[model samples]
Target: MKQKIESKIQVKWKACNHGLKPQACQHWLKIYFADKKVDELEKAISKAARDPAKYGIDQPALERRFKWTRTTMTQVVEYTLQAVVGTA
Candidate 1:
């Protein structure tokens, strides 16, 4: 399913280098690293992806904030983190 980024998140995320255009969660995530603290956002995304049910975070909210396809969103996010932090 196609998801859209929320206005609130978009405004908050616009500082990143991606220019706030439409993107998947993974793509949008790259911007975080480019403009802001990658590590901090990585942790937040990690927590959000792993056990999102327990986190009480809205998938739709994330989808809106990212416009990503749910299936690979977490995988790409984690993969990006691993690549940056170094995959062991």
Candidate 2:
């Protein structure tokens, strides 16, 4: 299930007009999640993403990158949560 969600995010990202690879997305998710559980990460990002300013300058791009069904957000959220939880 986790793989499915993450894969969806990857797929959405690949469909973007992005010049760089999707690694940046993964990297950012890692940094953002740093110390949270999978579910927690999802909850965190989903909530925080409500505010563009909080997310910062790359907002437009990142927001578009995550454009898609629940899958993209699911991936972003889950990955972040897992990374955070792992660190903790």
Best by lDDT: 2
**Candidate 2 global TM-score:** 0.26
- The sequence of per-residue lDDT tens digits that candidate 2 reaches over residues 1-88 is 5565455545544544465446655664554444234456456556657775776635665455445424655666676556435533
The TM-score values for the models, in the order shown, are 0.28, 0.26
Q: Which runs in model 1 stand beyond 4 Å of their true positions? A: 1-39, 67-88
Residues 42-74, model 1: lDDT tens digits? 557667867878878777776654443433455
Each model's backbone clash number: 3, 9
TM-score of 1: 0.28
C-alpha root-mean-square deviation, each candidate: 13.9, 14.5
lDDT of 1 at 57: 76
By summed lDDT, the worst window of 10 consecutive residues in model 1 runs over 1-10
Question: What value does the lDDT take at residue 35 in candidate 2?
Answer: 26
